[model samples]
Target: MGDHAPDGEPPPPEVEPAGRVITTDGLTKDYGAVLALDSLDIVVGEGVTGLVGANGAGKSTLIKILLGLLAPTRGRATVLGLDIAQHGEAIRRQVGYMPEHECLPPDVSASDFVNHLAQMSGLPRAAARERTADVLRHVGLAEERYRPMGGYSTGMKQRAKLAQALVHDPRLVFLDEPTNGLDPAARDDMLELVQRIGHDFGIAVLVTSHLLGELERVSDHVVILDSGRLLRSSATTEFLDSTGTLLIEVVGETGTQDRMGQALAAAGLPCWPQGHLIAVDTTRATTDRDVHDVIRDTACDLGVGLARLQADHRRIEDVFREGGDHVLPTS
Candidate 1:
């Protein structure tokens, strides 16, 4: 009746195993009159995929549905070749989830809590303990593993949460706001750790955040959501490619940028002042003479030193302001 195959039957292989790690089709969720997720579709491949959106953008709701903790009102999803509708328990066993908010008990030590969770994931007692130790060390919490989590700092608590998520040695990890409340240095450390989990450990990661720029450094692909609707999903490099605009900076007198803008405008180029630099729209340039040559010659004619000239790339936030219509299918 829905886009998914019948329960107990596997969905047709929409993509090669090496290409996609997860897929969803027409996934929607509603709370009475309010729709948390509108008929959405997406594909996540191997490596670190950043899911970005502002607060109350249904990012948390999507994670819960993927983990099988919350049911979608329509559509279906698959994770690691298992149906979320029929094999949620099996899926949870193979996948690990690090929730957004704090969930640690004040009375328990990090080591013990992580160990218990590993065992609950079906690991033997001895294996769980060993795995817990390895994960704690990897997360850089070896020294404080035995201390009460109540006294731990925010960064330390976040590390503990990450340790538990890795204790089970899951094939894929869903990290929800793993860097929340972290300072700049701590956030960088967390991001580096996330990169290692995907690169060094050969595990797939789906990390979420409201910050747009932070994930650009670490994510292989990005999926942006707005009001529970898909905005854009593509490889990180695709978003950073040239947007037909070049930013030019000149060094000379105090108003060097202004001088360059005026010279370029007089040369029949569409140029304007932007802060200390001038933005030149290259879309109008003639094919015979490249835009770069035009800019360089114009600068030479004006006798102003060209400090920097490069194409202006699009940022993730541009998707919202530009109302991006590019949506990649789950298949």
Candidate 2:
């Protein structure tokens, strides 16, 4: 049973929640100067942490090194309080990994596959059988668990992989691109299952994805990587807070937006056009009330309707842009 501790199944009365599920010290990886990970130091606590980046951003490299599938050129790391270099096997026993690509054998049923892996993880035969059933149901594959892997849809294949990852009752899980190759509805379903694994099942999750916005709905904290380096690491709430840029749209005649932009610039508040809205830079301004009054008076003087006025917030993609790393918006 994946007794989501949050669901009235709190940790044992004798045990306190542990801290720092993962930590890295100067973690660096160099494939003959490519430098996949560059002096990266980070600590991951409980709950869902989103690792976001585009292709070649060292996300996969970092996960592989942490899982002991690959070694770093220099630096040390730990997972679940076990040193990766010395206790790689022990770490693997406590952590689960759902790889990004297809690895399921076509002939075997998902039930057989999960049960076999559960046994491989040291579960007793009967316990393995029981756990396999529990996890498959947990991942929404209970009804389809008997089907051959080759006959499953892309969404079902993803769920089966997730079921195997959870069959062993791991303390943490690494979900690499779990929503990949899914349509909109299937993608939403997969993301919800991932959130349940972390939130409902009480499993620490490190989910990596190129789709930025998807994580905002589920992740507790977000860590951004770009070009093999850390861009930003903070709570999801902080990233969604007001960015101090006011998005205002003035409606009137044809040249109203441009005229408002010019008027705001003349008033010493730097402004620019963003499609249909004018982005007013408020960093140099005194206060929100003052800025609001100024904009309101400017619109009144210009005889235009204040269509929209609200503070802007940074998106996951904005983190990269702010860090001077230009990339296409994946959301």
lDDT of 1 by residue, 17-125 (tens): 7757788899999988778899889999999999987787788999899889999999988888777887676667767899999999999999999999988777888
Question: Which sections of candidate 1 miss by over 4 Å?
Answer: 1-16, 123-130, 250-270, 294-307, 324-331
What C-alpha lDDT values do all the predictions have?
0.85, 0.86
Displacement of residue 132 (Cα, Å) in model 1 is 2.8
- What TM-score, to 2 decimals, does candidate 1 have? 0.79
Number of clashes recorded per candidate: 0, 0
Per-candidate RMSD vs. true structure? Answer: 6.1, 6.6
TM-score, candidate 2, is 0.75
RMSD of 2: 6.6
Task: Identify the candidate with maximal TM-score.
Answer: 1
Give lDDT tens digits, candidate 2, residues 1-331.
2222223332322212376799899999999969899999988989999998888899989999999999999999888877777666767877899998899999999999999999888888999999999988888899988989999999999999888888888999999989989999988888898888888989999999987788877899988887888877889988788888999988888998999999888877888999999998899764455888899989999888998999998876676567574563566
